[model samples]
Target: MSFLLNEIAPDDPMWNKRGALYAPSGEGPTVWAADDIYTVKAASAQTKGNIGFIEATVPAGGGPVPHAHTDEYETFYVL
Candidate 1:
């Protein structure tokens, strides 16, 4: 897992901390492609390239094409 912060400015304090709280009751950018529901919750810019996250609902017996995420850590959770 390559967690590269290539764009991090040295003058920026790494000790700075921030957070957000949400109930997860909102819709984000969506597209109707490949018969799946994709909801982008957090984007790279929103997290300052620290992370990205999305929610996808694919129908049974259907799935997206193989994909890869370059240069970062990823966490996938199902509820």
Candidate 2:
């Protein structure tokens, strides 16, 4: 099932205090730009700039431009 941007929760309390982060399916701060949807499950601030977990939904033939991360690792999981 697909979820609208506003339908997901904007924030999670567990992220504020450096505690465990847990967001059920279809929950997170979501944004839309460049013809794609980006839902952030774990923000940089929540991870002390160490990591960020985001779920991206891209339409057919749509995706980010080729880019490289200079200071961090990036991974993708196709569902």
Candidate 3:
């Protein structure tokens, strides 16, 4: 099932300590845009499956850093 933006609550505990428009991951509190998309796992969040999304924007001439998934495959669609 699809969800609306307003329906999702911000994971406040995950917010950055600097009070910036970014959140830091555990291992490395790397700066992530406030709008960056994140997913909730089905088992953990009680959904059908793991959810995935993006909430950040690419600066002009900038793109996502190189990365890969070993177990799961992802499909992208542009609306």
Candidate 4:
């Protein structure tokens, strides 16, 4: 298995600005496309463009077509 590690310097100011982010279950902006659902749990604006949190629920054989995000990266976790 491969692992990615991220480390921040001890003096980094980012550490001082860290805070909790909570989104109670079933609470967020939801969008529906056909039979699929996309929820914006935490938007980019809320995270200062650092991240765009999304939770998606798609029916069998439903999802985005093969694509690439040129500007930034995207990661997905299957539930």
Candidate with top TM-score is 4
Clash pairs (backbone) in predicted model 4: none
The predicted structure with the larger TM-score, 3 or 4, is 4
Per-model TM-score, in order, reads 0.58, 0.71, 0.32, 0.72
What tens digits encode model 1's per-residue C-alpha lDDT throughout 1-79? 1222334332333312344513154655555557877666555655666766667787887666767768555566866
> Candidate 1: how large is its RMSD?
8.1
Tens digit per residue, CA lDDT, model 4, 1-79: 1112243233334332356456558866677765778776665555666986778898889987777888788898998
**Descending-lDDT candidate ranking:** 2, 4, 1, 3
The model with the greatest lDDT is 2
Error of 1 at 61 (Å): 1.8
In model 3, the Cα lDDT at residue 67 comes to 72
What is candidate 2's lDDT per residue for 1-79, written digit by digit as tens?
A: 1234333222545444345667558977888878998888876655666877889999999988888878678898998
Q: Relative to the unseen true structure, what is the Cα RMSD of model 2?
A: 6.3
Local error of candidate 2 at residue 18 (angstroms): 10
Clashing pairs in 1: none
TM-score of 2: 0.71
Model 4 CA lDDT for position 29? 62
Stretches of candidate 1 off by over 4 Å are: 1-24, 73-75
Q: What is residue 40's positional error in candidate 3, in angstroms?
A: 8.7
Query: lDDT of candidate 4 vs native?
Result: 0.63
